[model samples]
Target: MEVRAQLASVFHLDKCLGCHTCSVVCKNLWTDRKGSEHMWWNNVETRPGTGYPPLWEDQQRHHGGWVLAGGELRLRLGSRPHVLDQLFQPPTLPTLDDQYEPWTYRYGDLLGADPTKDLPTARPVSAITGRPIDPSAGPNWDDDLGGSAVHAAADPNLAALDPDERQALLAFDRLVFFHLPRTCNHCLNPACAAACPSGAIYKRGEDGIVVLAKERCRGWRMCVPACPYKKTFHSWLEGKSEKCIGCYPRLESGDAPACFHACTGRIRYQGVLLYDADAAARAARAPDERLVDAFRDALLDPADPDVAAEAARAGLGEAVLAAARRSPVDRFVRDWELALPLHPEFRTLPMVFYVPPLSPVRAVRSDGARPVSDDLLADPAALRIPIRYLASLFAAGNERVVVDALQALAAVRAHRRARTAGDVTAADAARLLLEAGLDEATADAIHRLTVFPTLRERVVHPPLAREGEADRDPGIQGLVGLRRRVTS
Candidate 1:
């Protein structure tokens, strides 16, 4: 059990209100530079839509991640020969057309305009070019427009649904979308790191945060198409590949990433996760349906005496172990089984997990009115959003797991509502909660973590010994601190 620590994240989709505060703050802080107009390091994509890069989940087009070849794992993108050929001319790479040509308003027209008969209007112009733009698409262009056949119909996840289900999913009233805020997963099995021919990308040993060295980068766009999540992007202006660093600089100083800090919904949770290095390959190689469970199996119990001994032997400091024990991410993902990784079939072993949203049961709620289906509030029927759709996103097409998770979430809500709303009897709540394998205490705990986590509660930074880093040579301290591995 070769224990190691990774910086893991959990986003409670249940609490996300589709507010773009996370995106806005991330843009303002990091990707606001030239050649990054279309790059959204943190983006909130609406479900039932094609997402930011337009059909990013269509691995058939992207040809990213890995595949079984001769009973061995190999990059689905290609081997070295194919990679060299596709370097300068990456046909599979997403162009500005796919991820819309970014535009900004000619704000000078509005802010500094001469008095005229017509209203002072700012025309939308290409952020890249000085010419006027039509503003055809944007980061959240498909937001709340899941009913549009042009947008939602093109969703790749819809492939899992039958023709009839697909049609209904695109229907106006049937369209109930959820927010999927995405960033670089900083995967345990990082395909981007492996695909970078320049070997610029490397995962930190201490925290598992994947980083790309600008100087070593050879300007090859291979990593872009190779990342299944499309998190890696080439900056035309900088001649380098860039991605979310998980705000490592801030993290070393005991601060959360800008997006996590600025999140209005308080849906983001960050913490340490202890896991076995030996399990990553097997977990990634698991059958698609079992990938989520395999990944969870990779994460060893931090509180386990045997696991703790392995951690100590593997050089994990006491502080990290403590953080792992207290990790809400561990509770949500492993203990309570409330959260799941997105697109586990991608096989990148993404560190970030999501607590799937529980859509409101289809019913009217008036004063002294009873719910149409008490089973929905207690037993969790696919009332608003189809369970199959969510299963595609999170469970690698495992509807059974999605059903169980949704049922568990519903049980928590039912337990709470009975006490607060008197909509159901205590017996009803207890029965449902028991059916879902939860008690009131556990339900309350899950509810608190999902809804009202404080900054300290949400972000649990393991003590990175920075005192000695400060005492190092000031000129090279930054380099020294970064290059220092966990084994060092």
Candidate 2:
């Protein structure tokens, strides 16, 4: 019954076009400073390929996120000695090969070179050191090459697939990939916050935005790998750990985040979610197969009368509750069950959810014929991407949730086709909805919300109930007006 407002987000992966527009705007706005040359707070990673920082999902190497031991939930960092060793030892952290060394062409060499037989060209020089260096890797080096034998072969998701399925995914024409834009999940039970000895990282009480107080940071470097998503970074130049602020300043002004605003695909949705604080632990401890449903049960329906009364007792703002009632995040995640949390086995209870993309289920093509929108995918097993591969990312190795999401997506397409054209039978569309566990009305709403949502429908920022302090304080930056400074 303890209600708290969390500003959660959802990314409809089906709509993402691998454009990287969101990443570019986020970099220009926040991570452009001296200490942040290598930090990409918002990054778009291609699936079936090792993501940024290479093999980040391989927690065996990074030791990020949480694990259940002896029926108790604890951080994967293990004992105190392990934490100290991992934190202090530079070699244990991400090497230059892991996160590519940031480099820029030495334009001075290109422009002001002495006359030569060949046209003068800029040599690649390390951005950190002005010295010339050979460059090989980059953040998105594997973009669109998810089917490459070299890059995709190294994906941790492929480990979930069998040898035969893996070979098919790597084959020339069977290749398919999708974009996965990532940011700090701002998790309910953040391991980064728990792992920080300095207590510099904390989730804000009002909005649930996880923040690292730079003033209290001691350059411990523990929070970097402690973040399962690898969202936290150590600023070598500044001697502090930093991460995405979740664009709180823009949110306070009643505007969506820069990345959300700049997104061309309109794939991002942000809103408040009210959850029982006590249920988070229970949900985290649930069995792997039931973990997703358990987490979904944690969110209290904002429309419930008892929830409103309990929210008032728990100090949830009236405005915050109203936002939750109409939150698109709630509709996608809780109501319709379209969006599911990423890597829930990590047990961080990440608030950000993703609507599994439909690109993996390529329509069946016959001899000398073209694939059409009305035609449904023949079989999940014969899909372009393996279900086990997606299961590893979204369902923690359970294919049922992934299958359900795909079926729902297919039903929507068939439903729309039947309505607009005679290519698909209406009875088949209705039957598809039944198999997908969605009603016609629900499917239509999902269609509008995804394809034709207005700006207001897409973003639902709650009133933080800061009690008017933020507007009054002229010196405020990044919700500094509302929260207290915890100085060590």
Candidate 3:
């Protein structure tokens, strides 16, 4: 039972005003040099739209991280050194375009001098490519235009529409907004370290912060694709993959990482957590309940005399232990009563935990009367809110699909609870689901289903049953009819 110190970050999204002060400070400190100008060791982007690199959510297209197939977790970067060597080999003239094609739009063109300007007169141009831009193809061209999870949660009337109609309404209303700020998760089970051909990427023994040893690096860029968050960057000047060091120099002096210290929103917190390395490794291998249970047990209680004695004996510092006592991860694990890996299905067992935002639904005017939409009742897509994209970035599973499924399950549970009470308010149900760990966007989708009039009728009962039905008939036909009844 060897105890290892881990560096963990706690972000309070409620406090995050989407200010880029943290990003700017970090860029000035680490990424301002040549060959790193385009690199943002830290960045903030609007979510649901493509991230900076565009479609970063499509992991299948990127071929990064582990995949579960045939009941086994398969590492894409081969386990052998030679295999990693081949995988990491540098490319010729490695440019930002290789990783991300920078793009921007012309907003001024749409606001032309003339009020009645049309077609050619209203067209804008691209800033980077310098081509005549199509307003339809530019960055954030549709920013915040689609119906958001927050909107759906606030207004439950949307749930009754069909998926296609709901999508159209979202596109038309432009209701949702999400802020995604990214940095290295510095994972407990880091794929970048595991995929390293030269073992250059190693987790610090003292802090569990995954770091790339510059000199030890073989210049194989496998870490670029191996990272689910895509935080690792290939440095042409250094000819290696580099990432946030968790500001080790700062941490050594009992200071926070640069980004955390500089954050205007106070969204970041640094602390130590005790974990079972052996159990984490085992989780990386089999990836089942035993592994999940292992994580649940590895939680360290700084106040517990026995746990404190064990930590001190394992060489953990008093300062580290002190911080762990008041850390956010400890609070979330022990008090908040919520546990979700950033992306559990990915099997990387990322330690980062996000407490999902519970967005409020608001009343909307419909047809000159206050008619609530049933968006929360049937369609999961009506939740126009955004879940933290970090889950898909660091977690070891099918990040998007798994999160979506979890949201659906939560919605079902909330709906059932509401039905039991005989007072089913789609908005209330959606709020309940949001509180249960579903992101605003997904919760709103469920809310929309619950509120939609047509969808409510469709989903409240099976297609085979009408008004009159016998309660206690035990015949096969009667059982089928009972199953077909719409109780809600």
Candidate 4:
């Protein structure tokens, strides 16, 4: 089966409060140094708006991810010759304007201004140029749907909807948005690693975390657009590509990632997933409609005896398999089938999955007294956030998967409300749960994991065998290899 253990995550979008605590903490920890001012290794993007590095999801323009041509999977960036042709000047690289210019306030101006003058203010200046400039954009400039007319209107996911539906989404009173926090997906088949001409980027075999070795980097900047998610960034000062490392140092010590740990909404869950490595390509090659299911099929159940034997033979430790058995990500993704990957059509096989959010019920006033739903829990189609829109974000234009996830979420809420508020009977809640294809016990378990999981239950780090490794530092290893090459 070619079983391999991979670290994975699940983010419950419904719980995300649009709080930037995750972003701020990730920034303070990883990308705060010079030349990385514009890089947010972790960023929370407001949906229905152009995300950071505007229009990154528009693969037609950026030419990121993979494509199947003549039944053979290949880089969407084109053949090696084409890549070489554009090596010096990649045609699809995002410009500085695309990624907002990082800036800082001129605090000195505020401090040194004449006392007699009117209230002194700090003028905004470019972090790069040290000159005063008008601040026009930021990573989360369109947060809470700010500048919806301009930025939100340009969202690429809107292209999937009909013209009328698109218009309705942009209408002032009808506007609805949600938070999408992002980082490097640490994809199973990372295009960034495949596209790196210098072989600098690599995915760790033990844990599937993609990382760039700075010592071997040649400042090619190829990984930038090669990543469909646009998580890889070029550092102008260091002349090397950088990205989120998944906070391996923290993970090695049995802790969750910085962003996951700092999240105010408790929306993040980290754990290990055991998947059949041989099946990844076939899964990625599946048709758009079946892509999500195909990917799910690639994840092997750790509890399976045959799978465990294969995993052990493949060098996975017992500790890792045990963690994988308790993995909340596995439950959310494979067991309950509630979480789905973002843009499965990208064919990167991202390990991180998201539980599609359930939006507030659309208000239809009756006699102008109050807004209410026709159905008890409100239909998925009647939610403020359209199932089609979420499908575009998560399911590769397949609305059915998104609808199923929302229905399951609704059932959980209904069950909880029935228990706590007594508005609905236990029988009624049971019917809703059955309708959603879940048993009462399963619903209750989902409720506990979603709303009130302990920290241990939230993040389950696998045994990486890092303790016994001799050459732990890549930098030192790189230097040793260089000295040997020169001496030889």
Q: Compare the candidates by lDDT and give the number of the best one.
A: 4
The TM-score that candidate 1 achieves is 0.91
Return the number of clashes found in candidate 2.
0
Q: What digit string (tens of lDDT, one per residue) describes model 2 on residues 1-488?
A: 55666889999999999999998999999988886888999999988888887888989998888998878888887665667666656344666677878888979887888888998888899888878999878878889883367777898889887887788777766778888999999998898998887889988754778988899999988888788889998886898989998998888778889999988999999998878877867899888888888898899899999998987766555677788889999999988888988899899999999998876444444343445544444244545777788888998888988888888888887888889976888988888888888888999999999999877899997654342465475333222222332111
TM-score head-to-head 1 vs 3, winner: 1
> TM-score of predicted model 2?
0.92
lDDT of each: 0.80, 0.81, 0.52, 0.83
Candidate number that wins on lDDT, 2 or 4: 4
lDDT of 1 by residue, 1-488 (tens): 66777879999888788889999998888998889988899999988788888788889989888876665677888887888887778777777786788778888989899888889998988877778989777788889764366888888888887786777666665567788999999988888887888889988754778888888999887889899999888786787889998998788787889888988889999988777877867888888888888888888888899997877666666777788888888898888888899898888889999988887554432233445656666545545667778899999998877877888888888888888988877898899888889988999998888767899999987765433453453332121222344321
Give candidate 3's TM-score: 0.62
Best by TM-score: 4
Query: After superposition, which runs of candidate 3 have C-alpha atoms over 4 Å from their true positions?
Result: 69-73, 81-95, 101-169, 285-294, 338-340, 362-488
Note the clash tally of each candidate. Answer: 0, 0, 56, 0
Ranked by TM-score, the better of candidates 1 and 4 is: 4
Residue range 33-150, candidate 4, lDDT tens digits: 8899999998999988999888999899888999877767799987778888889988888888878888999898877888865788888888889888998888989998898889
Q: Residue by residue across 30-73, what tens digits does model 3's lDDT show?
A: 98775564467777655444554444444565545676567566
Clashing pairs in 2: none
How do the candidates rank by lDDT, highest first? Answer: 4, 2, 1, 3
